[model samples]
Target: MPRHRQSLQLTRLKKAGIRSAAMLTLLTGVSGGLYLADNKADQEAASAEALFAEQELTEASVNGWSQHNVLERKVKAEQEAAIAAAAAAEEARKKAASTTSRKSRPGVTVKIPASCNEYSGNRAIGCALLLEAGFTLSDMANCLEPLWTKESGWNHTSSNGGSGAYGIPQALPGSKMAAYGDDWKTNPATQVKWGLSYIKSRYGTPCNAWATFQSKGWY
Candidate 1:
């Protein structure tokens, strides 16, 4: 019986959050049987406090879980920003390299492409050049093509041996092409640019002017 009583007392002390020293002091002042009963009562009160503390701790644990998930979202956002910055840097590098390659290439002149100059030197280049300046290609073929064929056979060097009108899309003074640029005689592009401006200001488009010229033969 004594051994059984000691075991019960130890169990109660463990549950009550009491130390071995406090239980020993209580046992020395009271009979062993009375000590056991008081130990059990204290244990019941401590058990109630422990249940309440456990409930509070469970609530705190839930709060910690919410905080952990929020931190994960922040981490993912930062990672995406880093990836975009890397892609932008790579694109800039490629563009810079392309510019450098163009600059270093041999025999690359900044002058107008052969397509532009080829037509420039042709006596035929004069009228086509001017028409292309303001209006589109369709405007040239529709408006100027037929009229010029009739007027001078698409001749740039055509001159009126009789009426004093000269050149393709002949103005009274073909020298008037000099108004566009100093190189009008040699630069088809400049002459074309001037001619288109003149046509637009005067007849609107070659087609509109052509219509008038067809009816009046002087448009």
Candidate 2:
């Protein structure tokens, strides 16, 4: 081998080494730039995804609040309705009690005279007849006494010109008592007997008849 040829070959080899180093540096720089751009793109995409997720979360929270508010309103309405219904029922009960009080009459206490014979003519006859009609002396004092006193004062011949009601029980037209006797117009005993029968059939008792009379002014 010649010395010059060997020196030329070494120079050529050094030049090739420098070219390879330059090429490696250029490739490394390009790869680094591509990596940085890809990283930036990935960061932007992650930021966008985070923003979308945050927006969805905010919307869900708003919807949840809206549903909760609706539920709260429904519960409040139901509670108010229940309170109103209870108040109405109480008012109705009070009104019913007041009406019942108005419809019923209070009881009265009365004192009886000692004997049927202690009364006057017609009064004594009425007292004796009342006792014979399966009624107590208390019934006469509390019911029959006041009842006949208000009707016809125990007079068999007593007549109402306006209504044609007559006799001790004030039978309308006075002929209704003929079922007991033809002498119902004049005989006090017959009128009393017919009156007692009518009271028993219609009202069951003299006290019941008196209560009806008190309530409606008629029996």
| Candidate 2 minimal-lDDT segment of 10 residues | 103-112
Task: Evaluate model 1: give its TM-score.
Answer: 0.38
Q: Kindly report which residue stretches of model 1 are placed more than 4 angstroms away from their true locations once superposed.
A: 1-132, 182-191
Cα lDDT listed for each candidate: 0.65, 0.83
Per-residue CA lDDT of model 1 for 1-219, tens digit only, reads: 699999999899787766666778787768766878889989998999999999999989988998998998889999999999999999999999976775453321123334434333332454445433555556655676677667766555677877776555566676676565554544544444555566779888878878987999865
lDDT (Cα, 0-100) at 89 in candidate 2: 100
How many angstroms is residue 114 displaced in model 1 relative to the true structure, after the best TM-score fit? 12
TM-score of each: 0.38, 0.46
Question: What does candidate 2's lDDT look like per residue over 1-219, in tens digits?
Answer: 999999999999999999999999999999999999999999999999999999999999999999999999999999999999999999999999976764452321123345775666666666777777778778878898889888997877899999999999999879887766666778777677778889989998889999999999988
Clashing pairs in 2: none
